[model samples]
Target: MIELLIEQRRRNLGGGMSVGRVLPFAKRRMVGPFIFFDHIGPLDLVAGIDRSVDVRPHPHIGLSTVTYLFSGEIMHRDSLGYAQAIRPQEVNWMTAGSGITHSERLEKARAIGDHLHGIQAWVALPTADEESAPSFTHYEGNDLPSWSDGGVHGQLIAGSAYGLTASARTHSPLFYVHLELEARATAEIPSAFSERAVYVAKGEVEIGGERLVAGQMAVLKQGASSVSATQPSTVMVLGGEPVGERFLYWNFVSSSQDRLRQASADWKAGRMKLPDADDQEFIPLPEGDPAKPS
Candidate 1:
């Protein structure tokens, strides 16, 4: 009964770009197959003085764009050309099957000075794989799979839990851990997971007993597996292996709603082909939001 999946609070959309306080899909409530979850920017770019993040090139069929940085530097270009530069904890896994186009900037050698925190996730693809074609992967930060357990400090960047396995190659059967407790900790989550959630970013967390702070987001209700952390906290645990039935519009995630209305008529008839950036800046498509399916 503890289901409140979209609190939304991060909305700055300014120049440095910010808009991820919560945009839970299809009217809210963690849409099917996991649709949309933006938490971009921890904010603050200073180093030499360029600070970048220019998002242009759009068009996605099913979905999979999970870029997770904990602090600074991001340079990812797409349309299948693939150009990379992701620092911090490192991870830039893109998989927009069927159709693609991408852009994500802020790496002019750290945009001059250096400092550009991060978080960008949008995973929704499982309708036989939603076209399945485009692909890209980059998992650095020591290749992911850190471990501590007592003083807390775990990192399994994508799929698989406890035992550890984070090379970032998930289509389903997901996990995505990244805990970091300092004083107290305890984890044992595995009830087979049909759905689960937890997204704190700094301190305090006790799931199952309740007590989650720092940006709050704790949704767990289907059988209630297991999760713990009391003091030195920093969490992010997503579930997986369920692509039951889906069809989300906006960013286009489909199991068939006519393939999200043929990808909104191929991105409004432009046909679809935008990826390629020199400076990066193209995020426009929001007017009369209704192609049918409500």
Candidate 2:
């Protein structure tokens, strides 16, 4: 049985850039620990006209940011005094436990015109780790687990799946996997986790005879057998134990609204620390609470 079907909302993120938002839907705020999900460009950027995937310094609290890319590169800098460049198949995991600031842009060497494609997700921290010390970690593609069998290629980006686990650590139980399938292939999806969903990334997919194209998400009901692809396709599979109810405002997420308000004030008053290199820029706090599904 299928629980829900969601068509991603194409959102313009300024500078003529846009992304497909796939999570925090009104019908279902989250699938497991995932609170926010965005699929960035597979778009073409001109050499002279477009220069970078520039994201200025921003603050986050009570959550972790996960960045996974399929192509291109990004240079990441954080208030924690961390700097690194992430390329295709790499992982950037940043936990904004108590609080943290960071920025992401095109890598200096790869800043020239090119194609960009990736997924960025936000996972809310459990109540216990909301105020824990912030941290950052990077993993190379070869460092994570991957497998090939029966025409299905899969990678465990974080957490455990298919009797294997990735090195990426999280405060809660969750799973994020990327799967690429050959034509006319069927991929088995075990019910190893409490919650799960399938996202069609590059081609056509079907479960229980329901078709899902690129940018569509199918929240599967219990007893999911497998997913079949009509043609060669790329899919992202994610879900896990719920993180419980949490409040959200702009870039901040917390179990207590008071914490969110405090973070908003601290960001506005310049009390929060920022990246040393890009501290000059900060995203202004939004007017009124724009909490989704309101």
Candidate 3:
């Protein structure tokens, strides 16, 4: 059964920061253990426009932030006093073990105009590793594994595939790949991946006998291998070792619901340090949600 990872178009959240869509785990029907996914933007920025997404320091307990950009530039500052600028095709992997806060912003560029496109994903960590100290790494584009087959270009941005591993270090086993196929070209999904999905960014693709256009996500059922394109296209493939069963409440993910509750209270009480820097932004929790019962 091929399920669609419904596309939620970017919604304006003001401050020039908009979220494309928030996909909850329940809606995904349990493809690989990935509980949440967000497609941030293909949004454009104008020259001389002072815009930035300063997420004020907030807390995350048991997850990792995987930042991938196709265009534009972003400056990342975290609680560890780590400051890094990520360009297109690079991966900024930050793990929030017990708790941490940070922010991301668009850096001013010299180009006459600027275009911003990227995806931000939240991967749940294992139960035992939830409280581990925070850490961060930036993988340059050239450091990722790349290959050509059937006239198509592919890059292993994170995790491993086709006997190649990208430099991006991940806690749990996962695969994050970027494939650019030429017109009428074909590429294959290795059988080793425990589970996987195809997200078409540009052009069109055919997977498991179904056609997927830009912005559509085709999530594969278990035991199925191999995905090919009908036209020249670019797609992101993500999969990995299953995380088993867990609960996600707001920004906290844990095997026990009580842990999430405790973390929330700690964050609200200012027990945790917001990620490192002045420009960070914080996302407010929705009102009256029992999961966030203060």
Query: Which candidate comes out best when scored by TM-score?
Result: 2
lDDT of 2 by residue, 136-205 (tens): 9999756679999989999989988898889988888888999998988888875877788998878998
**What is the TM-score of candidate 2?**
0.95
> Which sequence of candidate numbers ranks them by TM-score, best first?
2, 3, 1
Per-residue C-alpha lDDT of model 3 across residues 1-294, encoded as one tens digit per residue? 365555656666566767765345336633454556666667776666555344445667788888888887877888788889878888888888888777776665424555777777778787678778888889875778888978779888887788988886677888888888887777777556677787788788887677778877777776655566677787888877777776777667777778877887787667777655554346565444435422
lDDT of 2 at 80: 90
Q: Quote each prediction's TM-score.
A: 0.33, 0.95, 0.88
RMSD of each: 15.6, 1.9, 2.8
Candidate 3, residue 40: how far the Cα is off, in Å:
2.5
lDDT of 1 by residue, 187-264 (tens): 665446677777777677776677777676666777745556667777777767667656556666766777777677
Global CA lDDT computed for model 1? 0.68
lDDT against the true structure, per candidate, is 0.68, 0.85, 0.72
| lDDT, residue 241, candidate 2 | 89
